[model samples]
Target: MRERRRLPRPAKLSVEGESDEFVRPMRRSWTCLARRLRAPPLTALRFLTPPSRRRQRCTPGAAMADVSERTLQLSVLVAFASGVLLGWQANRLRRRYLDWRKKRLQDKLAATQKKLDLA
Candidate 1:
């Protein structure tokens, strides 16, 4: 049978007014500190926590189903407009690139032709 090794426990701090009671030392590891620091503030956490049963019953159908037809149409319109704007921007960039390339090639051809004429 193998003997089990017991890990050392963290040191505890005693409170000034407490007798026979000790508080565990705060973890100082980077991960522990990061978790503590990254935790949402208490006010924000209040909204994130599960709501009471009464509040759940008060709300209507699923959130997605609650959207009005006009809102849906507007959202679709916005999405289509954004897609068109993005495509226009992309084509503009492509045209600029092609123009720059054509100018570069023309300049190179002219330079070669000048050299040939000089020779």
Candidate 2:
């Protein structure tokens, strides 16, 4: 059996004010390497970190302050009208399908009756 050849380990490149623990063990792509090299250590680290979720919630009236009463009413009316139209179309299709099925069954019954009369 042949012995496996060992590959040389890549030399560690240290950044000022950054720890070795932060360095990824796996191989990084050229784009990621380029981005890290381009930006300052602090700026790069800042961008990499997730955003803080300590944002203040707006008051109930504060959100509606920008929106006018007429605009709000119009939006509500449009939503209601669209919902009604969709329901009407769905009902119409269902009724048409039921009618078609009933007609088909009646035709089949009539054909069966004709055969029975002939016999």
Candidate 3:
């Protein structure tokens, strides 16, 4: 009989999988930093210090109101953006979950049909 040929194993498959999971957090942090770097400098500066101290010669209530107004605007913008992201993520997750469930049910139905045929 002729000798059977064998394929060579990849050198790094196991290690590559482990390293990919290990680097995931670092990649996420880098993306977060990159996003922060790309965002408007004005918003970054406003948040660097407490809002009251940044504005001069204002009464406590007025300072609070100014801070509150700015805070409200920022909160609204963040909420809207995050809401959009979350909604998209939720929709994707729902679709994936439904697809998975449908696949599983089909698999079970197929198995049941096979058993019924054998019986």
Candidate 3 per-residue lDDT, tens place, 36-107, comes to 668586766665656564655778888666666678889999999999999999999999999999999999
- Which digits, one per residue and each the tens of the lDDT, describe model 2 over residues 1-119? 99755444456555678676555542344345557558576766566667888876887789899899999999999999999999999999999999999999999999999999999
Give candidate 3 regions above 4 Å deviation. Answer: 1-64, 68-71
lDDT of each: 0.75, 0.78, 0.77
Reference-based TM-score, model 2:
0.47
lDDT of 3 at 76: 92
In Å, residue 21's CA in model 3 sits off its true spot by: 86
Q: After superposition, how far is residue 68 of candidate 3 from its true place, in Å?
A: 7.2
Candidate 1: give its CA RMSD in angstroms. Answer: 12.5
Q: Lowest-lDDT window of 10 residues in candidate 3?
A: 5-14
Please give me the total number of clashing residue pairs in predicted model 1: 0
Clashing pairs for predicted structure model 3, backbone only: none
Stretches off by above 4 angstroms in model 2 are: 1-59
